[model samples]
Target: MSQRNRDAKRSAREALRAQRERDRARAKRKRTLTVAAGVVVVLGAAAGIGVAVADHGSSGGSDSAGRVIAPKGAIGKDSLVIPVGAADAPSTLTIYEDFRCPACDAFEKTFTPTIHSLEDSGAMRTEYHLVTLIDGNLGGSGSLNAANAAACAQDQDKFRPYHDVLYSNQPDEQDDKFADSTTLLTLAGKVPGLKTPAFTACVTGGTHKPWVKKSNDAFNAAGFNSTPTVLLNGKNIYSNASLTPDSLRQMVQAANKGKKPGTVTTAPSPS
Candidate 1:
């Protein structure tokens, strides 16, 4: 009874120990799987949140007003050109300017009356090409923002007045105040019946930002490196550094000598 009983007892003890070890291993595996699943769930949620934020950022923010800013007639290069006066005027006066440019402000302040006079008298037509060179060169959104707002103004047939007002109230080049849509809308109030909800939405939502970008691209493609570039009858009038408002009128008169009023003229090549 001694040796046989002792061996059987030892075998039973070893089997029980082995079974307990196997159970412990299974429990450890289960816990590891549960922790791994939790980690995956957490990572998935974090990735989803990251994607949502990225989408919001890329969408240029939400437009609460939901107003559509449509383009007016006579869209020129990049659909940003706002023409004034008779569309078929005898001579064509083209102006390339950036809202943040000081020289452009000076030019506009000095020559705006003369240009409008010619336009009102049906002597010559004008084309305004808005550019965002400041935004590209200075690393801010001012030029683009102003140009976009101006384009929006064009939608309401207020481009000419809005354009003049922008130049009149242009901020210092480094200020970047035009980056705020509220400032643009405030300036729009200068023009009669221009401060509407649609215009506000357009300015605030950057509705014409893509058009502004395209206009900028067109300016670059035209080989212009600076602002306040003026052309008359397809020639660079600003090239004559001594040109004045009076001289500009005389030049237009000369260019319109043979051509009749409301006569369409070809656009000049960039100098």
Candidate 2:
């Protein structure tokens, strides 16, 4: 081959090698960026989960009596326990739940039937303690408004109905769903017999603030450190798969084996 040809061929080979190096570098940079982006996403997700866990730690909640019903539905200075059954029932179960807590929602949907069955049978009474576990940092403004609205509904004799709607239609704990007063009022309308004006007035006027505060205080007093904490018959119900319907029934049956005539069930298994 001529020297010029040889030199041209050599130059082409060099250029090709240079292009290949550039391509390799570009691919490495892309791979590095992809890995970095994935790490960031994983970190963000983990952070969100941690926030949820922290917020739910305080539902430390459920039912009870009219010993002192607040006038005009003001969250009365008097501590109100929203009861599920006759006050004289042998076992008094308390459920501590956060509106934003997904696990609490699960428990409400899953085990509520058992509670209802017991209450219908006059075997138990229940009290609910509402706590605001989710706050602004956790992507919620807390369940504070919802608690107040629910209390206002109680003033109109529709506490249970409003309560059901709140739990059933719980918004995303990580979003702005239940954050506004309008949404709160909208939810209040779902419960039968709820007096919208009074409830809204109570909530807007902060009338139920004390009641919600009192509930939180009471929950703290009761040693609540987590959401969905169940206290049955003055005993804490521990978390266990066996707390399900069949197992709970078995537990009730077992407890009643040789108990007094009025004692139909034992305390909810503590958590």
- For all the candidates, what are their Cα RMSDs to the real structure? 29.6, 21.9
In model 1, which runs have C-alpha deviations exceeding 4 angstroms?
A: 1-70, 263-271
lDDT of 2 by residue, 1-271 (tens): 5786455434434433443344356446657967987787788788884312233322312214323234243221355566656555556677776676665666666666777677666566667777765542254554776776777766776666677778788876677576677887777667654646766777666565555656766765765545667766666654432355556656555654554323233222101
Poorest 10 consecutive residues by lDDT, candidate 1: 50-59
Instruction: Encode model 1's per-residue lDDT on 135-232: one tens digit a residue.
Output: 65555788878888888888887888888888878888789999888899889988888889988987887776765666667877787656667899
lDDT of 1 at 127: 87
TM-score of 2: 0.62
lDDT of 1 at 192: 84
Q: Which candidate is the best by lDDT?
A: 1
RMSD of 1: 29.6
